[model samples]
Target: MQSKIEKHVMLTKKLALSAVIALSLSACGSGGSDDAPSAPRVQNITYEALPAMLTFNEGETVRLSLNTKGEGASGLKFNWTVKYLNQDVTFTGQGSDTISFKAPNVDMHSTMQVSVKLDEANSTKTFGFHDQHLSLSIKDLNPPTTPAHELGEEVSEIDTSVLTTGSTWTETHKQNSRIDQVDSSYNLVDSTLIRSFIVESADQNKQVVGTNYCGFPDLNSMELNASVLSIKCSSGTSSTQYFQKENSFSIVQKCDETIVGVSTFEKKSNEAIASFGSLNMQFKNFADLQTKEVCAVVATSKVTAHSADNQEVAKEEATAIRLVTQQEGNDFELHFAFNEAPNGFFVSLNSFFDENNKATIISGSYPELNASSQSGSLDLDAKNSISNMKGTFNFVLKNDAGLNEAVEGDFELVLE
Candidate 1:
């Protein structure tokens, strides 16, 4: 029985093997392929370098970047070194696709190098820096402007007011007064005295003669305009003459002649002047103000004795004059004094000098001024002198001042 079973098992195994062989033969016969097509494998690589080059100041921050391009990397790494004066600064990074770092403070211009690697890719970038300092400066690009008038010539007359509202006689003429006087006579004591009266308003014009020469720069090459101011006598002796000739008085910045520069007054008073003061001035240093040496001026109201109606008269009238050198701490200011007369004064600025030494005076219209108050401006150049002051002046009279009649105006003067 055992021999029969073994024979059966062997037959079964043989039958199975026969079936597998039959199947293989049938597939081959049908033209079916035994081998199958396979998909293609792909791989990529990328790399970028950091800071090709850079420049920055000592205190400024330097930015570094890693440039890269690739695909399928096992790992990425970064190694950087800042080399300066044979010294090295080394650092490392891991798994980082890109990185940035600031450069250290270097004494001089320098260059730093960086190296990066990823799988089979490697890159290098160089950063450059230059050290520099910061600094600023100002200067005058042009020469100073010369004075407008010839040397030894008289300066334009400036008008200024005295602050004497509540002061005494000594204080009124000394401290509160904006003007100082100096002359050979009267011990060079310049109280307020008006002279060389030339008043030009709307209808009439006149001129005053002066022989004194001041050493002002001959700047007769600039354009100029004329300006005028009228101040009435507000206080002091009332018998002031209108026009007096051959009268000389020095309008000084100092009460004593120790301080010398002056705008002297000669041939004082005029018939048309009714207790008023007029000043005629030419423009100088009008263009080159920045380069000119400017000074403050004080207008003195001088009372001069004159003849009226051919009578050897002893009368006093106010006139205006200025000093060559400016008074310390005082700019060009206008002051009008009147004894309770409304609109008793009229101050006008008619002209100024341009850059090219020419005359420009105000003529057509007179600027309105308040006779009640004594304050204004005198924009004039002290370095140059003015000689010719021609204008026509008119006045309105008040009843309390004794002479309440119409006063006509006329003026004239010559520069050095």
Candidate 2:
């Protein structure tokens, strides 16, 4: 009986202790402070997110997000806007933690502003003490490229990509009265040059002479492409170029390193520098007078002259003929430019080969010979010194002032 009574008292003590502990736990769970604890609120937000870089291209899609501080993101409202210039742009998502949108087209997008505002679900969406905001700037993938000022027309890929197949680029720069050499600061800088590229192999790309870059530099270090060609220089003064036509394509380069020639030149336009081709044409001269700046070591031709009415004017005699050649893109041309011939005449016979190996003179000049017809057979003999000989030639020629004449001839000539 005494044991049963002791057990009942112990049980009563245990129950009393349990009640006290339960009351303490209840007070802790219910915020039992002198004043009611403040309700949770969104104090701020984290505007940072993954894919760290925010830069994007036109029509690119991207997502931005916001994280709340004083409150859970689910209970918070977000409003996002993109201000482009003076107008607000429409985006895909609002009233959410994240939003996505497409970039505007390149022509339309420049710099843009993106902003977001945060509000509680219980309050109207507007700027408030609890609300926070952030702004971001978006940029374009490609901006306007710097202009290639002195290189003539803007370069195209077809013009530069031709480099990989092995190309020749020549450059000649003249500043102040000097030719083929200059510095960054000068009175005036002019361009005139030529370069020959020989593709020995994939590993042996170099200039034809193996060491110089006429006007266009031999590419080195960087891979060859349409946009950039790097020069190989031991002096560390080399430049990078962008190629685009002619003897050398369009380029931004400085050529003074090493080049040699005076073959075919006009001083301006630099149009006639391609002094290399298969033109062994001998001059049909009317006088033995010393000629002016003709591109020839020596030349003489047996010829006849005529007037517009199909009448022979003079007998064949050695005069002076100047053979000048120029490379126009892919066309090779020979121009017989004469300052003066027998009877105070100014003329030119411009000739090129047709597909059938016939030399045809296409067009001539005003007060100058523009021979537009040809009927001929010509031969070049090395041992005999006969450059263009044993051919019966007929030509119908005209000047810009409409001086038309037809002259046919058989001549013996030597080009040395």
Top candidate on TM-score is 2
C-alpha lDDT of all candidate models, in order: 0.25, 0.33
> Which residue window of length 10 is worst by lDDT in model 1?
19-28
Which stretches in model 1 have alpha-carbon errors above 4 Å? 1-42, 50-52, 59-61, 90-97, 117-416
Q: How do the residues 250-363 of candidate 1 rate in per-residue lDDT, one tens digit apiece? A: 222221111212233332233322212234222221211111121111223222221211122232222233322122222222222221111213333221311111111211
Specify the highest-lDDT model's number.
2
Q: Give per-residue lDDT, candidate 2, residue 58.
A: 63
- The sequence of per-residue lDDT tens digits that candidate 2 reaches over residues 1-416 is 12221221121111011111100000012334668774444333333332312455667786775543333436566666765433566787788767787766532113345655544443443223233333332443453333444343444322322333333333222211111111111111111222222322232242212222222234532233321323332111233344333433333322222111111111112233223223333324211112222222222223333232224444322222223332222222222222222222222333343212223332222223344433333322233221222223344554466645554443232222
Each prediction's TM-score versus the true structure: 0.17, 0.27
User: Model 1 lDDT vs. the true structure?
Assistant: 0.25
What is the clash count for each candidate, in the order shown?
93, 21
What are the candidates' C-alpha RMSDs?
39.9, 30.7
Candidate 2: which stretches are off by over 4 Å?
Answer: 1-38, 41-53, 67-71, 120-241, 244-246, 249-416
